[model samples]
Target: MDSEKAVPGDGVVVRAIRAGEWGQARRLRLEALRDPVAELAFLESYEAAAAKPDAHWREWTAGAAEGTRDRQQFIAETAGGEWVGSVTVLLERAGTVDPFGGTVACDQGHVVGVFVGPAYRGDGAGVTRALFDAALEWAWAADVERVRLYVHERNTRAEAFYRKAGFVASGVRATGPAGVGGFELEYEMKRSA
Candidate 1:
């Protein structure tokens, strides 16, 4: 698969994660889990992620970073070679069950693990946008009908950005386990044929 495409501005380039870069991916994920909004932005806790074995991390990266048709992870890197953000997309097919235990009813892409570091968030940075663009581009190229993501109802920052990026609330609501404040809303953006 072709990788390493440059974003239009700010010298941030979006690229596919390669095999053997599991350590880097793990570090970035742990960093994302440390963000102030991490509790709402991600389902996994920093402690949980930190406790995972190296083999687990490697397998995780290998599955998404290997350019498999089922999923892909894209990262935004600066000119100085720092990874600032990431977004991952998983392609679901009809008849296949999703991580959420829902039966896949159509060919679609589920966007997940989206994040941009504190230093990279702001006007004109474009790290998050670039990462999303790359993932959506991959989804469209694969002919998926739509891309969908679930955002914690309290995470207004992510909701607004997703709306600005053309995603609309699909009226799908999910409640997490009883102790977690239980409310996430699904948003989706469809591909134009």
Candidate 2:
């Protein structure tokens, strides 16, 4: 399905991720994870993400796009069809436990793995805003009451962007594993009536 949003720059398209775009997704993901600030945003290392098998990529992309019972992924592509950014929203089920240690409430959606290529960043192409809009629309369509994302405490740029997109900090902090030595800041955006 093509859900287009008005981005600041010309010829930008925001839509659901394609089914067989695993190769492209994998490539873009690696590029994003290689960014200087990646350590604060993404959990997987470039080595780990790059080493995944084709089957893994296929499953990851497919599951992320169409979404399973739990997760969904979306992409923002330029008019020329280059992927400029991406976002994934994971649904937390009621009565079920989450890996982040919160009992699921109101079928919340957790946004993660958000990244925009450096060339596209700060250009106000609307890639980041478009991605968030699309993800929240999907979550609300799926009957989720609210959407949330965890930003690393050090990732001020991402926090600023999220704030611009109408997300407010819930004042919740979660610590990463010892080696990472960072705290995650949780931000949430609620579905509008």
Candidate 3:
């Protein structure tokens, strides 16, 4: 349970989703889906997300509530109890076919659903970095060879953030379902020795 904590003095606590916090999770996700750049930054739409039943969110949250190795969701909450951001990391085993129709040649942590509220963005607020730090920490501890994430080709802000976080373009591209509408760019960070 204590495995989740952000660096000090940021006024935000980074932790895994709790079983009963699904409603909050649902709210934050819907909010993220409504962002101006959501079409380019997310694979799902606000309408699609809002249509999901409470049970769906509860089940999804339960899986990530315990910090499991297969998948984990890290969230950032303000000292005042507002959920500002989240990141989900999923283990992609070697020899398996990835969601993008590619073979996963190495054990890797595939990062997804990355989002931070616009109010907490930029260098002035450390929320984004804190959430990613927790996510990367979890991925590395799970023994993944690397952590990778996909950004829509037009999502320049996301790509820039990933680059600043030590991730580099892998020269690989993938196209998601029609919801995504276009190709995605892959960026990754290799695990340290």
lDDT of 2 at 174: 89
Error of 1 at 115 (Å): 0.7
TM-score of each: 0.94, 0.91, 0.94
Select the stronger candidate by lDDT from 2 and 3. Answer: 3
**Model 3 lDDT per residue over 62-145, tens place:** 887754658999899888889999999999999999988789999999999999998788877888898898889888888899
TM-score of 1: 0.94
What ranges in model 2 sit over 4 Å off? 6-8, 67-69
> Which lDDT tens digits does candidate 1 get at residues 29-74?
9999999888888888999999999999888889888567889999
lDDT of each: 0.87, 0.82, 0.88
Candidate 3 ranges beyond 4 A from true positions: 176-180
- The true-versus-predicted C-alpha distance at residue 128 of model 1, in Å, is 1.0
For 1-193, candidate 2 gives per-residue lDDT tens digits of 3456656655777777766899999988998899998888998899999889999999888887754556778887787888888898888877788767777777788898999887767735667877888888778878987888898888999999989889999988889645678798989987778
The true-versus-predicted C-alpha distance at residue 62 of model 1, in Å, is 1.3
